[model samples]
Target: MTVTEELVRKRAEHNEGEICSLEELALHQQDIEKIEFLNKNCKKLRILYLQNNLISRIENINRLKELEYLNLALNNIEIIENLEGCESLKKLELTVNFIGDLTSVENLVNLGTLEELYLIGNPCTDYTGYREYVIATLPQLKVLDGEEIGKSERITAFQNLSKHYKTILKSQEDYFYKRVCRFLSVNVQALEKVQAQQRRETFSKKLEENNGDIEKIAKEFWQEKGPYTPESRTETYEFLRLQKEQESQKAASFEETKPRRKIFFAEDGRPYNINEPKIEFKFYEEIMENEQYFVLDIAAYKNMDTSLIDCDVQTNYVRVTLRNKVFQMALPEEVHPDKSSVQRSRVTGRLLVRMPKVKSSSIIEPQNTKWKRTTGSVEKTESKDKMKGGKSNFLTVGETTASVDWRNITNAEDSRSGDLEMQKRAPVHRRKERENSPSFVDNPDVPPLE
Candidate 1:
């Protein structure tokens, strides 16, 4: 698991802009073996967490000048070196590591801003006069291994340092030789294979416990660890990163194997309809003076090239091509292909298609209209006087003209009886005038009531 640029980027946050803008990063428990790509990609990092990994050497991080905190706990790091460039570093955590070189505390003598150091559970912590040596060497350290160094303690450490200096060096050299001998005697390849097997077994057990569901196991594990913690965040990021890679690979394979489709007519000579671009659109029909038109509006991107769009209007349907995608829609009414037109709006980038409907002519015959006038008056002489003038009301149909003679008009018996029955069924509610209330009298001298 060599730390690559991709892994570093995936484990980082606030990196949407240039990589140099990254300030804080977490790469814990990722099995990363070496620190890489950060010195070039994230030179402005302020805080970094690289604990619980397989990293053995601290290198390639001298460019992080703004770093304030560095966590390298639970790693295979043996010696502390190459940290002279972190000018603003205030806290360093190297707990639970294999660091046995007590003389490595000399690396902090140049770090003036370093205030706290943690070397708990490390081989170097058990060295004789370890606390005194560290306190005397790094004078700016306010706390060491969860304990605060007082003025009196710092003075006593300085006083005892000269007496224990040669003894500490001798012990450090012996431990170094033993560490080298152990490193040479162990089978590195077999150890790595065992570690890998153990990890797989752990994963398999978790999967079985969750009924062989990877997602369920992952959810349970992260939930048990709680949220907003380093472990949970790291695990979640790794899971998502692997998922994205798998999805990308599957997509690439699918694209390579997918069959191309025909957009227009099929092999059977039947027209084909397809909407490969999957553009959202609206369609409607309008009528103006017996002329029907079909309007189709396609929503397209504003920056899309206008040359990519093509349209073909047919009698029963309209076909549109958008960036090699065929979009065909059926129209209820047939349209004239020659008169159809298409336009695109510059402001909204919408494809507007105007198709004129096919015109149809209907054959009709003119018929004669009969006119009859019914009057309540029964006097023939009065009707005759009314028709004496040539200005009679007449209706003309095509080339024939006709007029009605009121003197010869007659009403039907059923119509007259029906009218009389309707009048009888009417409920007329009225009050008769008060007869005895007052009597009207005309006065010549009195004016009307003011």
Candidate 2:
């Protein structure tokens, strides 16, 4: 993949929406095949690390004049060049690369500030007189391949540079032939097929969502990528950039179009209740012993963080916010917000709110139910007809009788026996004159004479 402006800005540690303010940047192991955008944007960078990549050329970094350290180890770089603009460079690391050109070491002569140079594990390191040629050519280098160049070694390398010159030249020729054969043996078509496979795997999820429509996916992939040319890589990166921007714009549009809920007050100057989250809840008054409370239980989202939930309990209403969505309702009775307590169940994730009632109330009966009266007496009418052939037992009209017989008004079969039983249980000195009369056989209150 080629380095893009977005990638550079993201890798800038001190970047606060601007890349020029950055001093250090590390872009290692990102599979970057080409170097781009750093020279044009981050001109103030001091230290740069672009190691462990697929980069084959060193380019587009000549503008980093403030750069002091550069690390380009373990890449496909064959020759180190295009760093004449880094006047303040002190150390350079190019370890374990394919640098076969020993003559390219002379390029660092322009960077007079370079002190340490590392080229260990490179193709040029195995050449005859490689260390001597590097030390003699770059006089400013204090350390080479992790070893400090002593005064004696530097003097000896400069003296013998003439003798090893012909052998170094022969080795360079051999390496050139080897590099050509290596490139010739590689199958370009096979490498391209592998790259295409990787691209397919990258978009495999999109393919599955499209029901495995290869033709549609191919058309979409090559939408802006024009005919096969050297700039096809640049075209692919541009397409990705546009796709990301479009996604961001779509998200912003969705947020702008979402419906917003109004709480607190209605448009007509009345209190309003909103349940934007549509949470199911139960609000009721509970009477327990001497205490009464207004209980509200809401079925909030399960396993949600408590930090995302907010609650406010008022005298006659309640408001709960879940992840910014408001859920509010008016209470059936006034409550005390200060004395209210709220708890969340760990098992069911239910929010339970209990508010002390402002005015305690008892259980009220239904308005439509009727009740029997407990006060006042009931009067009854007395019969006027007299018993046949018997003296009047009931009192006559306007006559003030001293006593009246209650057995005459009772049922005939139960009067005598029932009254006798009651008279036996009654207090002593009660009247027995009626019992002494001679109408015992005819009296209906009397039991059978047999």
Candidate 3:
């Protein structure tokens, strides 16, 4: 880990940039004077984390011209104006720090490339009077704290707010909308939010309807195969659901894009880590979204044997992982959030998203099985000869007919449960029905006609 990254991780946040706990580095008095020499002297620095520090004034930070992400969260920093000269700043996190007058950010208009801004955990967030002023001023600023900004985020945020009110008001008698309508604000932004609110409500209703329909056909897909208690299951899904909700809410509220990291694609057809990574994480997210709505938040240092169910819009999803003889759910997504976008963001700058960290040795278990199973299974049957282990070899999703030829099983009842299982467990984005699976003969087993 880089020295700067080490500092951020050991104290303030997790490897994913999510804040772990305030207790990690609960500074009674943040000593900024110690870092003053580093701030001015570390000319190569790009991301600066002064969060949870006792830095009352940010006037000295104007000199770090190359700084991109500046975290002044949880500090005594009273003014945002002193950050004038840091035009290169792209992300700024100022969540818990109380800056009474948000006009302090007007000087940040110079930060053209600025994308994500965290303003959560602050009193100024509730002040609606000057919100439009801030939004109107910052155009490139897409994500403010956790949500999207001026264009998309604000529009979605307001829309959600409006729908919640309108739905409650509609259910009530005539005394509601009229008495509460004025407080709903009649600005164009508010109208946009209202419109967005309608869209989300419509979407949620549609989801509820679809979920009901799915409960019928997807009975086999429902998971009842885990060693989970009511509380454990509830907690797991709740964590996952809450996590997805947070991300979805952030996505809706965000106009800014995530920072791209360098990835290395090697000639061996495997990823080779480079000093400057060539492949970026944003593309990965886009792909993951296109393929599945829920992401399995696994540990960076450990292999992921489990997963969770999270949300796509504002709802929760389940995450699952199957391996060897065991299957499990990692974490749940129903975590509650008290912070708002006008609050600070949990993370800033780019983070290296380590994949599940699987090793081939780990993939095969007992260490005794590799020799035993391979040799034993090899002699079982000629039909088995053609088949892979419990896991089948399938072609890429977009690949040709040969890949899906296994789906030629003519009867649905003919051990075709594997395909059905895939359909059941596949994430919403990844659900695919093979048209060529002729449903005639089961490849895993011989045909009755034969």
Candidate 4:
């Protein structure tokens, strides 16, 4: 073991009651359980720095009840779990880590003492934006990464995000907004609007009961739901409910219809797989950078059906209308016709389709017309075939042309020649080549008289 490895098992002791230690445990590679020992041994561990190590678990430190400041930065931690009940974590440094989610960390809202957060190297490089996200989440993160909010560099970031939020709250911005919204996650705006409408209803009802003026009531309504607080909405309110509702309802309807999109089957009674390039299309509902429930891209199931298709399909060039919004999308189209696919999942676009089951159809015996007899077969052709003098096959018009043969052309040289052949054969409208065109063969390879 090295000196640093020995330091991990180090214990600071004294004859006094207790001693607080800001442990700087660094560069201990492949040591996942290093903090596990400290959690059990170090009773006075205040600020722990187990960064740049292989510390994969946070639950180890969760046992450190006195652990006020923890720096678990630069680790391979995927989930931010088990840090919920640790109400003493005033400062958290999660930089340079693979942590992508905040599942259980949201409940750390009660830790009102959280002041500074260093989430630099992790996915959250934009501390300003992530601060707001964590603000909305933890609601207690004030000083994020040694920077003060509502002042300094953070104010501009907040102002920009505030505008984005404003655009979402403003009138129906664009077609995409009616499809999916953004910054609010999936359909948060719709949920908030429902809540806001309820609050407005309650406020309006209270105002009526209190016999307040209509203008004051409107102002109060704004105050309750305005950008600022309930007390400041009087002068800063715009009654855009009707318009916002229309957009919100469109989004809600799309969302309501989205989860109902059944996957895993094709129309011909076959299980759908994601590998089917043609049949696979994305079912996307995005909240844009400045819009609510906006449809970024949409595709019809008819255009995405690949059951009848055989080969690889290249739909990289596709222009279609989705929920009245025109968008250029990339997906697969019919390329290879011989390849049969049972699962449809490869195509990524704006929607995925689960084709309806091919229900069995009852055989309809000759109801309209009886079949006519063939020459040597006991087959009955349709009566219409008698008028036409021949019976037709069930195959399509071009089924016989499936395989392509390279031979059997009139001229082999024409087939092998370059595209220059077509350019040469093109009509030039020239009367005579000798009179109009310059002859290279008539002149020698030597330079002409300058």
Global CA lDDT of candidate 4, please? Answer: 0.47
Candidate ranking under TM-score, highest first, comes to 2, 1, 4, 3
Q: Rate the local accuracy (lDDT) of all candidates.
A: 0.76, 0.79, 0.46, 0.47
Worst 10-residue lDDT window for candidate 2 reads 372-381
User: What C-alpha lDDT, on a 0 to 100 scale, does residue 48 get in candidate 3?
Assistant: 61
Q: Which lDDT tens digits does candidate 1 get at residues 251-352? A: 787898987675466676456556778889988765545666778888976788988878888887788877766788767667889988888889989988
lDDT by residue (tens digit), candidate 2, 256-302:
99877654776774457788888899877766556788788999999
Best candidate, TM-score: 2
Given candidate 4, what's the lDDT at residue 355? 18
TM-score of 3: 0.29
- Residue pairs whose backbone atoms clash in candidate 1: none
Please give the ranking of all candidate structures by lDDT, highest first, separated by commas.
Answer: 2, 1, 4, 3
Superposed model 3: Cα runs more than 4 Å off: 1-30, 33-35, 150-450
Lowest summed lDDT over 10 consecutive residues: which window, candidate 1?
Answer: 363-372
> Would you give me the overall lDDT of model 2?
0.79
User: What's the count of clashing pairs in each model shown?
Assistant: 0, 0, 49, 40
Model 4 shows how many backbone clashes?
40
Model 2, position 121, has a per-residue lDDT of 82
